[model samples]
Target chain A: MPDTPFIDDGSNVPLSELRWPDDDLTRIPDWIYTSDEVFQRERERIFFGESWCFVALEAEIPEPGSFKRSYVGDVPVIVTRDEDGDIHVFENRCAHRGAEFCRALRGKAENFTCPYHQWMYDLKGKLMAVPFRRGDHGEGGMPKDFKLEDHNPKSLNVTTRHGVVFASFSESVESLEEYLGPENLEQFDVVFKGRKLKILGFYKNRLQGNWKLYHENLKDPYHATLLHVYLATFRLMVAGQKSAMICDESGRHSTMASAKDDNIEIGEETASQMKSAFREGMELNDPDFLNYVQEFDSPWTVTMQIIWPNLVVQRELNTLGIRHIVPRGPHALDMYWTMFGYEDDTPELERQRMKQGNLMGPSGYLGVDDNEAIKYLQDGFKHSHSQEGIVKLEPEKEGSTETLISEASVRALYRHYRQVMDI
Target chain B: MASTHPAGTNLSPEEARALRFEIEEFNTEYARILDEQDIDFWPDFFTADGFYRVTAKENHDEGLPVGLVWCDGRPMMQDRAAAVKTTMVHAPRYLRHYNSNVRVTGVDTDGTIHSESNYLVIETLMEQESRIFQAGLYIDQFVREDGVLRLKARDCIYDSLLIPNDMVYPV
Candidate 1:
């Protein structure tokens, strides 16, 4: 691809070349919060330019002929598995007109037929047929040189790791392994775990906040304790404790982790309720509350995997899930949360997983609060008050363990986001 | 004219009007409890083991089997109250609930009664520039027991799906 004027050096110069202060940290300007111009630039530069977004898990379209319509940063994409079990992703728009061809959320289809004009496309995005194209005599007919093969939906470069599929609009994007980096791949392993997953269900939430707020919410270690106290009550996560706000070199991938605090002594009332609820309460109701069962090889009680712009692989207890933040508008974002478990999970374990799942999803103990806060954050941005916001909690080291109440991870996100959006 | 009244069932036309007024008052009081953040008193609007669910209409319509917030029993509700009051850190704001169109649908045996009403809630946050956070309707189901009407279920059907911020309180 030829270089665009702004990206001549193969680097996002708008942000990186700025004569910023020599200090290691800086507060992000608030205009990015409620600015329409910033969003449009982001759409062109980052979302449509050079990023391999995780579109769908291979488990979603398990059998051959299964297809699902999704998006990569507001651009419509159709992901399908052909009879040969090969997964392919292509633009969802029809060749004749720019109408969305795949209307259904998901289904098993050999070929897709456009509703507007009777144009047909195969699962591999090949233009199969057009109605009335072979007419014997007609005043209005196809041009003699019209070629169907030339109008096939353009396919994107794809890569898969542990049944997780990713696609890139740019051919220059590094391999999926390198793009995700070693630290990120390790986090992916925590949820994917090299096992066939069972998609329990999907939960969608429309939040009136900037897409950046959702990213910062997950990365910020400051809010978990105060915003979601239900976790604290159950000794799941406690604020003001030893924790890590981790970020990679590029500041894209991040993890907000905390050690299981053993100091939470279970109350008699809570213990009694747990004992009565479970017939065989092995470690379900640990009196000490610090019983980290070592479900994964990691040390964190919960780690919110900030996968670049959209994906967040949340390992919350036994009920593992992924949250994809689809940007709807400058003030709105849709959270598509997919909850999953291993194929061999037992009934009792499944029940526990569902109950624990309540701690995260839309109705979850934490998720709703996050949603409410996001709304307020947007409402605040609509004012003429402040221009710059601070994220200087851990100025010394970008990825160091600290007291749970720190926003270092959020700072890392803004730093990387500024680079990607080039504002 | 030979007029006969049913035994132990005596009420004048004006008395019926007074009963309607009392029911409306009871409903408004429940809303007051929530508006004031008096969550401890809010549970009094339900029975000990009554179910509570605050869900989006989309999920409810599709039988999507999920809610923004779901409390199977009052114990869970109480637990949420305990958590939010102490541990949930969020921006301080006010929720104003306005209820009207109260209708007494039917009378139940044992003096219990079923009723329905409509409501609107306006939320305002106290930032430097006070802003209108959200506005939505509240679909409520009520039951009268022991000479008092209590809320059975309160489904907050927000017309706007995009919430302004993190919802820190029970609607």
Candidate 2:
């Protein structure tokens, strides 16, 4: 590893200069993680392209006139419910001057009034009023042909599945159900299942790494058994557990799932392989922390769904959350977490969910490992002259796998990524 | 909900001042333990049934039930301490905790004290400049265990909406 001083400006490497190291997905070029040109291209071809990005949960803005500030990739947007109880997603930029008008994270309002010029827009993002349309005292009035509707702010194609909200810049994008194929949809529904969601709260943290690394982290289960000693030591998701890394037809989305088996002992060979991660005699003083209430109908106790480009639906035991990945340039990304429970949950169940929440988040037992690892990875890519990352765990496998020791799902993600990015 | 403290037991000015002094002293020691990164001893500052949580003021003001670190009991805190010490992987760093403005609000009939204080935690990583990691207010409920003040509950409500990377250590 050469400790070369790498300049991050887009000028260092042209987009045309970048190419795959090999014709296969086993070798991932480091430029994809550290190049500014690649990040800009991702914003265009992936985030603001044809993909549907998860913006907000319907539960966040449940009532009419409720609104929450959100993002599609790096572009700020507002997710709102209008007077008609219809959900809408539109740019937070004011139609008149492009100032980010909505500042509060979440609130209820009849309409939004831009503080810059008092240009008012209805909840549906239609320009309803212009303070100087006729000009104050008729001095600087707009042209006679200016129409209020013509000046409306940009809006995205909005769709909802169960309680999750997704938005796309492309008007002709596929439906949300079709976007998440049948296999992925089945696993998605296992957690959603039409039950009203109760918002527990939120956790926001910025990880100093490429946004794609977050998706890859969830898709790569090999690291789960090796990097996170807490998870492996407790057998929440050890290597020998019943698990599957199931990918969608397009290879863009996947679900890394595992069923917790308390009585099933780890085989000797597997235990030896995971010796560094598993502690011989460690135990939680409160054994109830790892208790599985068995609330869902699915067999897997943990199903971490990497839904294409921006969403991660986490069903880790009883703790349920949606992680929205907001890319910030190439070196940093903001992770917004929305933790929830069903509306009809008993007080005890809600508390249990909160207790279980300790396993994930910026400060969680397992989550801290991933965040730190991502930071270290970004540091490695930024400072080192190394140009390739190896993903050849199971050389012959590509899509789904029954073994946790494979990087098949990671390879599958890049297979779709290369096509979508046209690299 | 009615007040858990009994009415008409308002403390004298001298008693309130003395209680505030005790709380200030207790917080100074608490901050020292965390600043030194002696996480294994972190659980001992709390009562057996102690509750600890670290949440953003946005969520705390909205009465949200979630926490970045929600531990319902001292056992859970012990688990977190043990894991942070033995299992979790993070960059080497130093943290300095500044706790001030201790105010004792009330004392229940059982001598449990309600208090609030402002805190600032500055972190310095290897080869990096020190920065304010978290600035928060700690809302606490304290009780005497064998004549020493121990926390019954400590709600660390952070004012920073976006954590820098991750809170590797508890504040």
Candidate 3:
């Protein structure tokens, strides 16, 4: 928890600090959120390791020579589409002195030139040229054998599916499809659906909690009803709603789906108990704003999908979007949320998406709760730092379940996380 | 975008001075209620049929329709207030809103005032030092409803691309 500079070499830190509970994924150590060794090891073992991380959307750089800057863990990356119409991702760091070559969020450029010393790279991240390669005024220059090809920035193995792009630092990592697993991919295909995407805009928020908590926040459905009164207030999500947690075989990828049941039936026992927590006299004068237009064939009104390490494809009743996690260090992370709708959406649909969007961003009806809960976690994890936090809501299983009230999904996420992290 | 004088330049010096006084007074009262965390009175500052949005300057410049906080009418604004009270779970913090560089850009045909002001909110959370929560431009349109200035449209375009943690309340 002390001030520690980001060091890639975890060997320097004590092994005692990076220790996890004796139990497999049942108990997560608080130190994982604050340990410098774990944070550094994760960069290499999980992020730069064999795990395929979601870097960017292929739709973001649809045009030839279009590029968008992203990050794989803390390491900056550039996702670009070359003139040949191939999508590629490479380290944003310049080969020369490691300066970030691309500064803009997105732009069209045939070449990415590092401003530090004008070291240029092609769209595929192949180092093209270096200024003064052959000495300027016949004085001094590069050695006759100084090859431009030798200085190419590190590039990731890239793949695109359903308009989303996944990149892996390790060429040996499983293909995007294999890594995402068939079950989770099915839910992903639901949001993407081969339709052209229209990017509404981005809402980036810097959080005080570790990035993993945000991932856990999405995967954990038990907190939804308790934390977000808006969901229950509007009957969007209830205590015992018709829902299912469809987790992938690997327990890495998952989708927590909750269907909105119009045919009301809450037993009196549950009703009286929940009524105490539900906000009374609360009414939406414009109920049309929260109304779901039934865009997807699936009866789910709320779906939070986690494609591990970063990508969170969320479908919160017409507000379809992706929340990309950017982990800064042990205690902080920045969330880059791209709120969008399908290209073929009508004006009415667009309005619906915009109106519903207020339910998810940092200021949304539901989002505000998460922002607070995670910070409270960080605060707890920091000061009174517990050795292990409980996640036994649905103890019988850890991957998938039918109950909306369970921590099984989050427990599954950690189960997969530990496999990769080896904490 | 900064507002340019549309009709204020044509006003008599006396009339302009009086308008400036009235507008400044309204902004002061608005800031006080917000800083005090008076959510109930927040919507009262606007007309029944008003538009309020919190967005980034990048989106504003591009004319993007999306906003961080978008409320079409007083009902929605009231909902926002009610949500903060009932459902919203955010760290309690003290927000001090400072509005300055107030300018009445123009006067509409029916006496609607188009104005712009720069605002900075300093947030002090429990046991944490006060920090710059948000700094932005308030692009506004005000109309006299019953001889009192009520905000018709308030577009708070924050220049910072990233908001800290989460925005519990409006800017």
Best by lDDT: 2
**DockQ score of the complex predicted as candidate 1:** 0.17
Candidate 1 lDDT by residue in tens digits, A1-423: 221132222122233344334433557665666566677777777777777787898888999999988888888899999999999999999999888889876779989998998799999999999877756576566787888998888787788888888887888988877777777777788778667887765666678778888888877776665556456555666544556766666777777766666575555654454432211212222132223345578777778788877888887766578787788757678887767777877775655565565567665667767877787777666543634567777566565356665666676666676676654
* Per-residue lDDT of model 3, residues A1-423, tens digit only: 332234332223454555667766668778778777778878888888888788877777879999998999888999999888999899999988999879988879989889888998999999988888889889788889988888889989988787888888898988887888888878888888768888887778999889889878877877777787787777778888788889888787788899887554556665576764566456786777778888786867888998778888989989988888888887889988888888899998998888888888888989888998998888777766255787878788878898877888888778777777765
Q: Residue by residue across B21-138, what tens digits does model 1's lDDT show?
A: 7767886787788789998776677766565655554445534433455554566567667555654556677887777765554444645444455666677765433444334455
DockQ ranking from best to worst? 2, 3, 1
Error of 2 at B76 (Å): 0.8
Candidate 1 chain B lowest-lDDT run of ten: B1-10
Q: Which regions of candidate 3 fall more than 4 Å away from where they truly are?
A: A1-13, A16-18, A263-268, A271-276, B1-17
lDDT of 2 by residue, A41-67 (tens): 999999998899999999999999999
- Give the per-residue Cα lDDT of candidate 2 at A422: 86
Query: What fraction of the true Cα-Cα contacts (under 8 Å, chains A to B) does candidate 2 also have?
Result: 0.88
Show pairs that collide, candidate 3: A135-A141
Q: What is the C-alpha RMSD of each candidate to the true structure, in Å?
A: 9.3, 3.3, 3.3
> Which regions of candidate 2 deviate over 4 angstroms?
A1-11, B1-9
Off by over 4 Å in 1: A1-24, A134-136, A226-235, A264-294, A400-407, A418-423, B1-66, B84-86, B89-171
Calculate the i-RMS of every candidate, to one decimal place. 6.4, 1.9, 1.6
